[model samples]
Each structure stands twice: as C-alpha cells, then as structure tokens.
Target: MQSLKEGLLNRAFSHIYVEKRAMEYELTKEILKRFKESKVIEIEHYKDIFSRANQDFYLQKKSPKLILAVKQNNLIYKGADVCEDFGNKHFYYTSIMMNCIYDCEYCYLQGMYTSANIVIFVNLDDYFKEINRLLSMHPLYLCISYDTDLLALEGLTNYVKKFIEFAKENSDLTIEIRTKSANFNLIKHIQPQDNIILAWTLSPEGVIQKYEHRTPNLKRRIKSIKEALDRGFRVRLCFDPILYIKNWRDEYRDLIEEVFSNIDADKIYDVSIGLFRVSKDYLKRMRKQRPDSIVLNFPYDTVEGVCSYDKELSRNMIGYVYGLIARYVEKEKIYI
Candidate 1:
C-alpha cells in the first residue's frame, strides 16, 4: 500500500476549515455528504471511547466519522508534574480537543482513541470558567495542547490565540502550548504572554523523515521556534520520545549542535527530555494496524501498560543527550 502522504491532502474534504461555532453535527453532515461512501464514527454517542484499552481507532479514524466536539468536561488535575519530573508537580492539564491533524505513525493517538475523526470541543468558555474556579485556590500550569496540536488546526480552530488572550487576562495561570506544527502564522497574531510558554517537540531530521509522517520537518520547526523566540515568546524545547536509531548518537549530536547554533540559548526558558514510550495496549494496536512501521516493530520493554526502550538504553540515551545539552544550556534550565 502507498503511504498516507501519497494523497493525504488530495481529498479536499479530508481537512475542512470551519468557524468556531459551527455545530459539529452540521460539520459531520457536510462531511458525510461530501464523502457519502466513507465510514463515520460518531463519538458523542461513544463516551469514554478512548479510555478503552483495546480500542482500535484506525477502524473509525476516517472521513464521515464525526467525533462530536463537546466541551472539555471536569477533572482539573494540577497535582501531576509535567515538566522535568515523571510525575511531580501540581501542574494541571485539560484536553480541549481530541486527535491530531498530522498522522504520525509513532503517535499514541491511534491507540488512545477509537476514531481518527477530529473532535473540537466548541465550549471554550466552560474550560476558562473551570480554570477560574480552580485558580481560586492555587496558580495553575495548564497544558493546552497535550491531546491535540492546536497550532496545526489553527486555520480551522483559533484556540491557541484565544487561549493566549485568556492568559493575558489571567496572569496567575501558566499556559503551555506544546506542538509539532510549523504554523507560525497563528503564533504571529497574538503577542507573547509572560505566562504562555510555547513548547516545540524536536526530533532529528532522520527520525522525523522516517517516523513523524505529516508533521513539519526539523528545519521548519526550528525556524518557527526561532521566529517565536525572536519575537519574545517564552520558548521551551522538547527533545522527547527520543528514538534509538542507527548512529543515533551522531544524528542527535548534530541535531543538538544545529539547534543551539540557530537560536539564542539564553532566551530559552527550558528544555524537556524524555525517551520514547507508550502504553503496551497502544503499542499492540499500532503494531497490528501498521505492521510495516519500524517504530512499532522495534523491541520494547513493557512496564505495567507503558512500553519503552529497555531501562539501560533509556538511561544511556537521556544521560548522553543531557551531557551534550549541558554544554549549551544551564543546569537549572535543563529538565530530564
């Protein structure tokens, strides 16, 4: 079978740009009419669909499968550390959307959701109100792009800019927009907020070419990051899910040097590091769905439901990268 890139964007309706208030049902109807023969996975009726360990998203992640875009529900978790530690702080994260625009084979979304259909929770005010209520007690560090790359879908959903505006008013809240998108146009519209940190996930050029699928290349991402930093955005680097590839050391060394060479290290807020990892349940589904994926086929050790490189390899990779990064960034700014 040909790669998804063969004609990923050829089907015009595959990516429908809609206004924020456009009813998801109406959008679904429009999509279904456009691709009447395609499958539709109705997610509004399928609550807790992603929580299922054995869910197969590839079956439903396609045209006409309109996952109802609902308001982000409850649970304002602020007690889990999201930055440097595995699980340390009370930083909170809430998902305003589900699924992503890019189709990265290594992404856990395929295993986490039963539908590939994008779901945009139209009720943004509800989340803002909820955060306000939570902020009554403690300052919150909210991860807005944890579940979806809001930047990539900015043309359809202007959530990030809205969130930035929201943060400009709510100075007590720390908002992080983590993304793999090269959509710098969206970031340009809004002024950089002191509390809003733009986090970009970086991978070596080879790794991105081999596994990242529709996401922007490393150079594009770096260019975007540099632009944001130059414009005074509090930028964070995420060297995450570091894959152990052939001559990975040389590749990553070059990547690190290349990154620091382009951007001002002093202006950077911090750098986050994490080895490749995913739930074993998610891995099983992806492996079966994409048997040809080298990322899935690689040997991984399972701890509970999470599958990652063996402990030794994971440690060595992080340690080596940490040492390489220490040369450019301060010890305090590095998070592992």
Candidate 2:
C-alpha cells in the first residue's frame, strides 16, 4: 500500500459511508485504512442514500461525502454514441467510481446524476473478471475512467495504479485512463505499459479558470504530460467539449500551440477534438442546476435528441482548431 496524500480540496474525508457487504473487500479495507480520521457508517446498499429524493446535487458539491459500496451489477457497459469511439469496433467503458471531485460546469455527470456525493465501487476485481471473460470473445478498447476522475482521487483510492497493473498483465486489453489531474508522480516509479494510454483533457488557462473549476491549470497538466512522455508512457491529448466562449478561436489556437511546443506531437498516440454537446435530458437538468452559467445557458440548437452549437459554427470551430493542430501532428494521428 502506498502512502496516501490529501485530496484535491486539501482536506481528508470527513464522513465515509460504507456498504455492509463492502467492508470485507480488500479494496474497502485499504481505503478505510488510508482515511483513519473519517467517520465510517455501514449501510445496507448505496442506492438507499445515493438515490434519495431531491438530494440537491449542486449544493452537496461544495463538500461531497464519500461512499464506498459493492457494485452488484452492470460492471461494464457499451460505449455511447455521445462519446467518440475513435473508430474502434470493440469500444466499452466502466464506471468504477461515480461523480468527480472537480466540478467542471460543462461536465455531463452533473446533469446525469441526481446526487453530488462521490461513490467508489470497491469491486474492481469483479470488473476485471468480467473484462477477461469478454476478452475471450475478442480484443477490447476499454475506457477505465468514465464519469469520474480516478487520477485526481489516486491519493485516496489508488485505483488508477491498480488498473495500470491489470493492463500490464493483459496485453490484449487496451485501456484509456482520461483525466484532468496532474497526479502522475503517484505512479511515476511504475513501468509504463504500451496498452495503457494516459489521456489528458486540455483547455486554455483563462477557460480553465472561468469554467473548469478545481482542475489543474494548463501549465501543470502540460508539465505532467511532458513528464509522462519522458517516462515513455503513451500519452493522448483531448480537446473535446471545446467551450464556445468569447475569444474561443484565440484561446484554442494558443492552447494548441502551447501543447505542441511542450509536448512532442510525434510521440503522442493521438489527439481528439469535439465541440460542446449534451443530451437533451442532461441539458434540461443542467439548465436548472446552473441557470446563470454561460457554458450551460447557451441557446444551443437541438438535433436528434442532442444539443450543441449550430452545424456551421461547429464545423468552423472544429476546422480552425484542426488546422492549427495538423501543422504539429500528422493528420492520420488526429481523431475528430
């Protein structure tokens, strides 16, 4: 067990809710040991609290309680169309953790979930068991960290480190751990695996400050990417959900240049780009949660149950950003 560090909020878990059946799991015991100062209460099930009526997701975000429970079903799921597949036929994702510590307004998790508390499913072994069973069918492209930032909570859970080791043992399974946390040092000593892709989401400093709350600044994330590359890890840069804020062109142009200037584009696995788009249901919930947020309050056009900037604007924005990045990275290595 590695020595645990403080959370991104610079505070320990004040209160931790543990499921009755989950207490015996090794992962649960490891987490409990890390946060000895937290108040632990055993519960029958996670949904009893996680699904309570009107949990005020926005207010609870200021100080979200931690929930450790056993994931009884749906250990893994097929990738959704809203998410980019990068043309992989065997794409899938698993949510070992629910909700994120960082509160980015553009994040779809806010609108998807009714509660804001953090839930870490301590049944990762079951996940791997199911994945290995499916691997017998064919190769897999797995997104290990979906709807949560495992890297940011690494100090408290160390789940990312565990996933890296699993990927190392199974070369047939390709795993992508996308994150905004600059916590690469936690696993710097571990050998890098070819199947493990470290995908980092990047935005301009100004945009990060104004919209991406509680996330590391552009410089810190880029520095971490450089370190990961220097350590021979396969790195990927995600410019998805490109916010349509004022001066977006200048912001993204400079962001791309800054990324290529510090990162060797040739060494990166691939770069992905997408404009901000949300499901109709999520957008409705987001409007109620953040009535005044410029990111969510935009009068986006709806098409086929999804909402986003108009088609022409989306094309231009994606085109301009792609043009800038193409100069640094080969077009074949880029994903729309």
Candidate 3:
C-alpha cells in the first residue's frame, strides 16, 4: 500500500473531461493515452464543466481534472494594459489553455475562472490560422502560453514544440512563451529562434516557498534560464508582480545578485519589472477563495478598477528593483 505521503506526492488526476469534438483530434488521443487511468467523461462543451456555478476552485486544485476541448470564438485578444507590451505595436495574447498547473496563491486564475481544473484546447490549427490572418496585415507579437505553463505540460501536450515550429515558419510573428517551470529538457533539442522569447518569471526563494506554491525554486529557475541562454535562446527575465513580503528589499536584492551570478547579464533579451496588481473584480474573488493568503490580503489601493500598491510604495518597489537590475544590465534593456 502506498504511504499517505507517497499517495499525495503521486496524486494524478483520476478524472478527465473531454469535449466530444476533441476526440476527433490526435492530440486528444495522445493526452488520453498518458492519463489512461483517469476516467474519461465526454461533454458537449468545455464551458459546461469549466464555467459551472459555485464550483470549489480550492478543492478541485487538490487533484484537478483535465479538460480537452476545441476552442471556439475569440481565439486571440489584445494584450491587457496590465501586461508589458515591450514596445510591440501589435501586442496580443491567446489562451490555448485555461487555468495553470501550479497553485500559486497570488495567481489571478483563481478569480478569473470558476473552476480550478486544467482546460487544454486541443485545436491548434484554428489558433494558427487566426494568427496567420492577423499577420497578413502586419507584424504580430503574441504571447501563446500566457494562461498556462506550456513547458510544464510539454510531456503531455507538445504545444511548445508546435508553437516553436509555427514561429519559425512565420518570421513576422514574434511569440513570447512565459513560464515558471524548470522543465528545460522538454525544449532542449529544439534550436532557438530570434523572434521567439522564452520569458521566465523568477520570484524570491522565500516568496516561492510561502506564496507561490508548487513553482520551481529561484535557484532551479535561474539554472533553467542559464541553460536556455547557453543554448542561444533569447531569454527574458520577468521580476514583474514583485510581492510585498517581510524584508522584501533584501529578498529581491539578493535574488537579483543570484540571477546575474548564474546567468550572463549581457545575454538576457530584456528584464521586466512591475509591482503586484490585479483587477478589482479578481481580487474580490481571490479573497473569498483564499482567505488566509497574506500575499492576497495586502491593503492595495484601487485605481481605475485595478488593485495595487499605493502610488508611492509602487514607485519605490519598482524603482528599487530596477536600480538593482540596472547595475548588472544596461538600463535600456530593462522594461517597466
């Protein structure tokens, strides 16, 4: 018999929700093969299960089920003002998946989605076609894996491989795949492309252990970034959404030193810094979902429907971190 700790550590989804149309695709079959033990339940639409009322996002996260579905309308959206556009005129983001594998206490997904189950949109051709349409007019900058960690799901989804191939073929389309995963082995074989930026969101070790649950440690993420840089990939370091914790100045300062120590500062494509901010609606939902999370319980100020640190504190935090990072890299290479 498996010990209690062993059972918890080895806990995989025992249930999988499949859209009836998704069964027609090979990707769905491939994913199902990996989760052969999971009981498959077919449904007409993913939203039927995903958008249900009063679903326990917290409980479902314990052993979240997987949903394979075909994406419908609104495949691509203009990037939100909250995100850094990096001077791209045509900044946009797409959700090939909803919800993330990691259960970070500060993640907005808890408030954005009613359920915590991972929803994988199996239809890639539609997304690519839409991008091609947009590219026909002008150059495009898209974040493909913004909603979920494609690298972490590479073993099952292989979406990262497909997106990389797509980017290679379309030189006009620049893609940013952001992740907190240390799963570099998944893309180690693929040659890096100039237009593709693999952005890694690094948090302090203390923050990761306390608030960012299930995420790779700071050292592991830095190591992954170093490996990616060594492999000729254009890597972007994101210190955005810097949480306010005890001794935050020292924690983040030490983190920056550790990052530059392991990775070559000159090789980084760029660094992005932003203080923690969430939509007013999302924060309300998050508070209800995680009542005890100190990361989410901060007395943030609401500015135009977004909740974040007060102007003075926000400026101080961003300025301090930016100064620390600028010491290692050129100021022009850092984005606010």
| Cand. 3 Cα-lDDT | 0.90
Error of 1 at 322 (Å): 0.8
**The 10-residue segment with the lowest total lDDT in model 1:** 79-88
Per-model TM-score, in order, reads 0.84, 0.95, 0.96
lDDT of 2 at 250: 93
89-116: candidate 2 lDDT, tens digit per residue: 9999999999999999888888899988
lDDT of 2: 0.89
Question: Pick by lDDT: which candidate is best?
Answer: 3
Query: Which stretches in model 3 have alpha-carbon errors above 4 Å?
Result: 1-10
Tens-digit per-residue lDDT, 208-292, candidate 3 = 8988888899988988888899899999999977988999999999999989988899999999998889999999999999898
Ranking by lDDT: 3, 2, 1
| Overall lDDT per candidate, in order of appearance | 0.76, 0.89, 0.90
Give the runs in model 1 whose Cα sits over 4 Å from its true position.
1-68, 75-88
Predict model 1's lDDT versus the native. Answer: 0.76
